[model samples]
Target: MENKGNSESTTTTTTTTSTAPSTESIGVAKDGCNSSRILNINVGIMGHVDSGKTSLAKVLSTSLSTAALDKSPASQERGITLDLGFSSFNVDVASHPLLSQRSEIANHYDRVQFTLVDCPGHASLIRTIIGGSQIIDMMFLVIDINKGIQTQTAEIDQIPQESRQSKIDTMSTKLRKVLEKTCFSQSPMVSVSANPGVVSEEANVNNNQQQQQQQPLQPSQPIGLNQMIDELCKFIEIPKRDDQGTFLFEFDHCFQIKGQGSVLTGTVLKGSIEINQTVQIPQLNLEKKIKSMQMFHKPVKKVVQGDRAGICVTQLDSKLLERGLLCTPKTVPLLNGAIISIEKVRFYKNLVKTNSHFHVTIGHTTTTAIVTFFGNKILDQSTPTTKEETGSIHQFNEKIEYSFMEYLEPTSLEYPVGSQFALIKFDHPVLCPLESVIIGSKLDVALDTSGCRIAFHGSLLQGIDASNRQILHDTLRIFKTKVKEGAVERVHSEDTLIGKNLFSKQTDLSSFIGNYLFGILLVSLSPLDYYLNLLLKRVDKKTFL
Candidate 1:
């Protein structure tokens, strides 16, 4: 990959390489200028209203001549970056022991690229933030000095833990299956242990405790933050390949330390940050050195992703550092504008009467921008065929009227918001690559049963010739079909079986994912189970080649 940088422009060269390493490489032409390799780091800049995310993004990107902020004038006039901004700065990865071995590592720091993302800072846009946060490396929460840990902050605290747990649970289950298979291969006749099924048992018990904890412990109960953070660490995925991985930096606050002029505090999401490392704030034209660092209160030689650290920088002042600005090593690409493919969104109410400016939050960062819904158009309260510039437009043009609001207008304020009516194309790019996509529906249990049946049948039809695939796929499909048909058919077949009696037993996606994984694990461990081996042989006869 070759990249060129000039006073006015910078270009990046990226290619997906095969497993084999090639001599073809990205080179820089600028003499004396150090070549920097871009590191992928997803940093979510978040804060309350007026926390200075736009100010910070400008300073960070201006140094590079191109930043996301440059694309929109609305950001400058409002003094608020209403859309998520992306800018890359090079950071020195040489200090990282793993990266130092690469000859090109040192050259990469001079142009350390940081993707500057600005998110909406209000509570209304939390869902938008969550959508991006699921994909990013880490989150940078900007805490306003005047107001510490606002309601938004408190709300965010629960999210990291919840998401972390879900990931951990998912990973743990996967790991357990792998281990179980390995063990079965080693010992062919091992008995299935249900007695304190170590991992599974602990998870079950802990899950109960977690449910209790979520409900709010007794006032006297000992709930520790460290314990929660420690639990979160188990799920946090670290880059295994070392070089081509991502890191996260959650900037909680920016301030002027007594001795050091400008400083920031946040936890590194994945990679490491070292002293004297140059950090770039693109909009500020400020490239500063880390004078010192401290993690978990103790002064440390360096900090890595996941470690909360306090950083003191040279040159930039506290005022110059804003909420959304990210200080990154030069080798990473600044998240510029992204052409996101978004599934459609349908509003539930009359959005023309409400606020025109809909908020977009990516990770912890917040921005307010126009959400143009692609697809169909609907009528307003006046039932006018004319289009209004009030809210995001939908795909449908027919004035279809339905009572009982189920969808939300892009302009209408709603929670747990989602859409499927059309594709959404952001006017400006946000941090993540893909737009929020809604899968499945939230209909009644009866509908869920039928939906699962439909999903499973679709999967089965796609794999009719393959025996194993057929069995597995057919089993799932049949399971759902049975559930739905039984509930409905049984209601009349056996007067004893009532729809109301079977209403609460609907299966959802979670069950689907779990069951699918469990089936995979059983097949992977077939050598240990004679019954499974026999099952496989029979199923393989019908496999689709």
Candidate 2:
């Protein structure tokens, strides 16, 4: 069967010219090797299923990895990306108008490598899409030029060729409006066609037949590719990197090589790693020495934060690992539960109730957790109206007094403003670093529903180990209020009074004695089980009764 949804092939052309360097020299490594620095930035391609996301990635990429472009048999058979696909292309730093102006960067860096992360857009693969989003520095929301934005694009009457450009602009405007409620509100939208000349139904049929036969087909010239590249370089900002911090790597693909042991492909999240360096997989509690490392098939001595690379390690079973973290020994903690700073997604219409189960995604892992809502009195009084105010208020502080909440009020109500928090008890232990972003979703919600599945997003304030739960409880002041009512039976003496139904048989009378109750001092408790005598001081007997 032909996979009509597979992206058409494209040919990219590049030209190189040699030039003599000026007096300012590029940095060199200790070994005296000329180190031409290449900065890597991850860009995610996302949209609804069959929205031409994979097609766009294919057209832009110059180098493809083993995991790139629906390489899986299942994905190819389904004609959609089933997992994350990785590919990349390099752009000259001096070619960009903005980047060339920065003498400091242009002097040190030779090129910028844009790693395209192709995320599956199918509803059933939303978890995979979310995992892919975590690693990307930016995103491309692709829309099928013919059909525009859709949950799943179906066969429709083709639009007249003359009106296609106008349609693309209209779709871009609609996409911007939809993104206004999200963090990507300021993101730019670009219009491009990966396969510009394959618009006729007969050509599509022929391409599908060729794909079914597993034959390589000639690519049509792409449209707006240069413009897209220009837009990318202009808007892209180099993110701050922490190469000196603890080493952390998130592996999304692992496979065994017959004689080379196993190779793990992933992005470096923090710090740096070198060949022969020891790294531990905390989830499996396994440690292995890095036998070799490669960045897009080029051997590299070291890889720093934000770089996409594949590490080969000996004496490790690749089948035993799929997706997890590799970090410096003992760097990531195993969390049984966690207290997180939370904010409701305004688009989510449902109430977040206490003890409710949610699919909590931390880093690339998604696991079920029971959520308990809590907040300080400050939240009850006022709500933050803007992102700036919300960030300032919702920060977790142990000194702030908090009370248990039955449920988080919907955004429709004015009460759910200000700082909100949640104690998440995970069903399974997760290896997570401190301050990691946590996303809560109701994944069980029907995919057909128009409502947003993402209920909330937050950051981990504190992690709770199974053994250290008590310490957290004692450290944070979370209290519940209780009230009791009773009638004064009669005046027992000049300084005392008898109260009835005040203490139940199960109630600890001694606890009430010497304690303040509704501003009245409970001086003592009587021996009688059904009645208790309260010793009142500095009060008339008639008034006390």
Candidate 3:
């Protein structure tokens, strides 16, 4: 009886141990390797079409996501990136000279994961590039050494071996000139050949047997890759992260597994998310709890701001969500219109006028919006300052009064002369949060033109939801001045004068009382008598007649 009891106890103990979750299952081992914290930095790879952006991403990345390297059939067939591609590589924090110098960073982080965002370079796909640019911490403006600057170099070094150095220098100088007036003026430039001198398999097979035997084939290797990585490490700065704020994830891709559920792959724009937490898809008005989460294929219990992650949620239809926001319940508002603080892009030379339509891109969504320009009356009346003397405009202040502008005049390229605001009415409702970045562009322009299509960029100062749009227009203090001219036809009395063509019969003349016309104060106005009978405050009959 004692031997049987001992055997049962042993079996029960083994069963309990087997069922217990391991450290890796709970994500204690960071990145499934060690307990070191992994810091993620997003690097955007941007350039003109056929500029080797994808090749660079492929050579630098150690781990590829499901959507990386132009996996789409359309992309492979067309031989151009149709959408954004994502891939990543791990860098040793201790080994990096610049990162290791920072004691706090080196002590806290064991590895730095660089998530490369490969954006489409086609002119028609500029909208996608604009969306991808918003999420990047740093940018790589690749250039094809053979072809100097092109339309989309916003911001490659695949060149001949003999003249590679000279070509790189020339391209770098030209790039500096192009970026001199832009935000990326001081960004470093690196030259590299992602794929160097490799014959296709068909070409190798077609070679004669004697020639092949004389010259053995060798595998092609990337040139100057280490130098590019070094430049990136030195130029990248740790951006400020807000993990305590409300969780907001902007997903660019969505798909479903057989039984696991739907997976949302995107960068965490702000705050943090964890497994089993309930999240809301505000666009669809659907809520689902997170079943699991992964960062670069390694399971993690939590992901914070700036971290690229894949979140799995059950019972959610992947078809319903292509690219949109997922956040804490009731966090994002559905907006029909917005008031934004706008500044003209220096490269755009076209006039920005009121009532004009622009392609307004907010987050990953691009839609048409009609713009109405407004500025402070005092500032508009003041003497215009030179571009060099101007300063940045402050954000929209509700306490100050503003006057309607017919159009926006050219201002300093470096800074705005005064505070400017635009009332943007969207053609359709957009799901976005307040204070989101807004970019307005004229997308209908000819793509072949050698000019910038981006007109202006700013941040949302106020969001007008569908239900409160009318209330906002009535409450906001944006005014317009009007002038009415007329000649007196006759005089009825010393205090009254009859004028023609001043006010129509349908016009409400009650609001015109106490207004001045021809240096005479109007006490009252009656529009029902086929003309305006303006009752003067104090005037003689002879003065009017």
Candidate 2 lDDT over residue span 1-545, tens digit each: 00111111111111111121211221111222234587788988776676666776776676788799899999999888899999887776765666677776688787777899999888878888878888888766665555444556544233434676666566556655766676666655555556543333233356456422223234345555665666676666778888897999998999999999999999998899999999999988988999999988778989998999999999888889898899999989999999987778877898888999999998789999999988754434355555566565356788878888888754432444445789999999999888788999999988888788989888888899967888887887877777777766775665565678777889767666565534343445555422332334334333322
lDDT of each residue in 296-363, candidate 3, tens digit only: 78888999989899999998889988899989999999888999887777678888899999999998
Task: Tell me, by TM-score, which candidate is best.
Answer: 2
User: Highest lDDT: which candidate?
Assistant: 3
Q: Can you write out model 1's per-residue Cα lDDT over 1-545, one digit (the tens) per residue?
A: 00000000111010110121111111111222334233434445555645444433433332221225535576567554454445433234443333344445444433333344556654444443443443345444333322332343322122222243344344334333533533222211101000100111122356456433233222221112122222222222333323123333555457775765676765464456677767765445457777888632346666664344567776666775445434464422323222121221231222321113333444344444332222223333333321243234233322332222222234222211111132122335333312222221111223212111100000000111223433433332111112322221222221121223322456443543322111212325434455544444444333211
Each prediction's total of clashing residue pairs, residues at least 3 apart in sequence or on different chains, is: 77, 0, 1
Order of all candidates by TM-score, from best down to worst? 2, 3, 1
In candidate 2, which residue pairs get closer than 3 Å at backbone N, Cα or C atoms, i.e. clash?
none
In model 2, the worst 10-residue window by lDDT is 1-10
Q: RMSD per prediction, one decimal? A: 25.3, 9.4, 14.4
Model 2: residues with Cα > 4 Å off, grouped in runs: 1-35, 102-104, 145-148, 154-157, 198-219, 377-395, 409-418, 481-545
Instruction: Provide the lDDT at 195 for model 1.
Output: 11
* Of 1 and 3, the candidate ranking higher by lDDT: 3
Please identify model 1 stretches exceeding 4 Å from their true place.
1-250, 327-337, 343-358, 370-545
Q: Can you give the lDDT of residue 443 in candidate 1? A: 18
- Candidate 2 is scored at a TM of 0.78
